[model samples]
Target: MNKFTLLNGLVVPLDRANVDTDAIIPKQFLKSIKRSGFGPNAFDEWRYLDHGEPGMDNSKRPLNPDFVLNQPRYQGAQILLARENFGCGSSREHAPWALEDYGFRVIIAPSFADIFFNNCFKNGLLPIRLAAEQVDALFKAVEAMPGYRLKVDLERQTITAPDGTVYPFEVEAFRKHCLLNGLDDIGLTLQHVGEIAAYEAKHRAAQPWLFA
Candidate 1:
């Protein structure tokens, strides 16, 4: 996983609520064991009119021009401002995978599904839980300026807008530590490599008969 110390990028306003995991990546694209290449099909159903598959012709699919993500100004958006109950439904890890692949680093919502929120951390994506009022304020600001971008400083737990408006957010200490250090489960385990090796050596010496 990559370190998420800070990010400054365009904000894409997804005003809808109850966005489920399947809607994120769809069920068909779940066959791949690898995490890469899922970005192209991130929002397959919404991004294309017909079903989209890898290597399939994209010219045929009619895009919804009105969709916030389809608009040119919102291109390359890294922060997503969403409504309540974001990332609901099935506990699919692919949801975060698709989001990260599509270049979304942080998601700010009034609330999020417990599973999806947890999945974001494992995949190096930041799911920010903010109050409804705060979310509404962010939506307002982003809507007021189409290309509005926010800079999120993970270390300071602050989000700064282009107009110098800053909003503070709360994140768990453990998650913050992991993200700052770029440590996944395996990376965390490896942190105790020296101690683990010492313990193994002592155990082997103390129980040679068991190994035989």
Candidate 2:
């Protein structure tokens, strides 16, 4: 996982609520757990006009002109501005994988599903919850200006708008620490490698026959 410290990047609004995990990355493409290559297939159903499948040539597929992501101005956006209940439905971890793979480091929404919210932190994606009115303001700003961007300071736990307006958000202390250090569950465990090795060595010596 990548450490998230600060980000100043373009913001694109998805303007939709109740966006389920399936829509974020369609089920057909969930065959791999590589946590990559899903960027091309993010929002597959709405991004393309035709049905998508794994191993399909997405480059050749028809793109939906009406889709927000397909618009030229929103290209290379790293911050996603969304409405309430942004991520809902089945708790597939793939959803955050696809979002992170798609270059979105931070997702700002009024609310998010419990599981999806937790998944985002594990995948190094910052899912920020703000007041509905604040999200509305962000969505409006993003659409009103091309190349709209914001500054997200995780350490400060605040989002700075283009006009210098600041919004303070809250995150669990443990989750904040993990993201700041880029430590996932596996990484957290590995931090105590010496202790783990010591315990194993002692166990083997105490019961040598068990190992045999």
Candidate 3:
């Protein structure tokens, strides 16, 4: 996991609400837990015209030009500006994996499903909740300007708009700390490696007969 400090990147507006995990990274692509190679298939149904399957050549597939992601201006976007109830439906960590793999570091929305929100933190993606009106304002800004971008300061817990407007957001202190230090669940556990090794050694000595 990479530490997320500051991210200044183009924002792609996913206007619809109630975006479920399946929509983010459809059910078919969930078979792999490698947490990678899913970027090309992210939003498969909406991103392309044909039915998407595993191992399909994404490059040759026909893209849906109307989709926000396929729009030329939004290419290489790193921040996702979404509406309420984003990541609703089934709790699949693959949603965040697809987004992160596609290079999205931050997701801004009025609200998010609880499970999906928690998964985002564990997978190194920052899911931000803001006031509904604030999100609406951002959507308008993104539509008004081409190549619009925002600066997200996770430590400061603020988002800076292109016009110098700053919006303050809240994040749990523990989640904030984990992202700042790039510590996932595994990373957190590994911090106690020495103690774990000692405990295992003592257990082996006490239960030598079990091993034999």
Candidate 4:
């Protein structure tokens, strides 16, 4: 897990609503839990013209020129601007993995599915919920300018536009703490390593037969 203090990156507009987990990373690619290599296959159906398989050469596949991601202007974008109900449908963690692998650290949307939103925090991706009007304005601003970028400050809980327009967003304090410290579930548990070891040793001494 990576600590997400602040990020300033180019924005890519998805321009669609009701984007589900399967759409983010199709079902076929879910076999591997490696949390990587899925970047190439993110949004497989919409990103490419042909059907996508697990081991297919994505480089040779025909790309959808009309799709926002394939556009040259938005290349190397790290912030995804999306609409309402983003990350709906099945609660697969792969969605955020694909997004993170594709170089997006933060996702700004009007709304997000509950499960997906939670998964983003665990996986080091920042899922931001803002007012519908604010998201619309951002979409417009991103489209109006090429190579548009935004600065996201997690500690300050603010997103600043190029013109210095600041948009305030809310995030739970506990989640903020975890992200700031780069602590995932396992990382959190490991924080009490000494206590866990001591407890185990005490238990072994109390019940030597169990250890034997």
Candidate 1 residue-wise lDDT at 207: 95
For model 1 the local lDDT of residue 146 reads 74
State which candidate, 2 or 3, has the greater TM-score: 3
Candidate 3: tens digits of C-alpha lDDT, residues 163-204? 999999999999999999998677688999999999988988
| Best-performing candidate as measured by lDDT | 4
Instruction: Give the local distance difference test score of model 1.
Output: 0.89
lDDT of 1 by residue, 69-107 (tens): 888989999998999999999898999999999999999
lDDT of 2 by residue, 11-111 (tens): 98998889888899889887885767889999999999999999889999999999999999999999999888878988888899889989999999999
Residue runs of model 3 more than 4 Å from their true location after superposition: 189-212
Over the stretch 1-212, how does candidate 4's per-residue lDDT look in tens digits?
Answer: 88999999999999999999999999999988587889999999999999999999999999999999999999999999999999999888899989999999999999999999999998889999999999999999999999999999999999999999999999999999999989877867899999999999999999999999
Ranking by lDDT: 4, 3, 2, 1
Tell me the number of clashing residue pairs for each predicted model.
Answer: 0, 0, 0, 0
lDDT for residue 55 in candidate 3, whole number 0-100: 87
Candidate 4 TM-score over all chains jointly = 0.88
**What is the total number of backbone clashes in candidate 2?**
0
- Would you estimate the TM-scores of all the predictions? 0.86, 0.88, 0.88, 0.88
lDDT of 4 at 100: 94
Quote model 1's TM-score: 0.86
